[model samples]
Target: MRALVAAAIGLAAAFALILAVTAVGAPSGETSPEPLLTTVPGPKK
Candidate 1:
């Protein structure tokens, strides 16, 4: 029972660490030159 609890806690901590690193490492929209998602212009009638 103790081992299972420990494993769960460890997994949670690792997931949190990964999420923090990814959030911090990613570039912000303002700093990036290109838009993250581009849309095509619609044809004029």
Candidate 2:
């Protein structure tokens, strides 16, 4: 259990670090985030 928890945390942190680096290290003239979050309203039954 402890090992599993540690591995989970490590993987999460690794992914987060990669994302942070890429987000900060993007080359010139490229954008990462979109202008808006997309959501659709469901139709009533």
TM-score for each prediction?
Answer: 0.55, 0.54
Please give, for residues 1-45, the per-residue lDDT of candidate 1 as tens digits. 999999999999999999999888966565768767677869899
| Segments of candidate 1 deviating more than 4 angstroms | 26-45
What are the candidates' C-alpha RMSDs?
5.0, 8.6
Off by over 4 Å in 2: 26-45
Local error of candidate 2 at residue 40 (angstroms): 65
The number of the candidate with the highest TM-score is 1
Error of 1 at 20 (Å): 0.2
The local distance difference test score of each candidate is 0.89, 0.89
The digit string of per-residue lDDT tens for model 2 on 1-45 reads 999999999999999999999889857796768676587758889
How high is the lDDT of residue 35 in model 2? 70
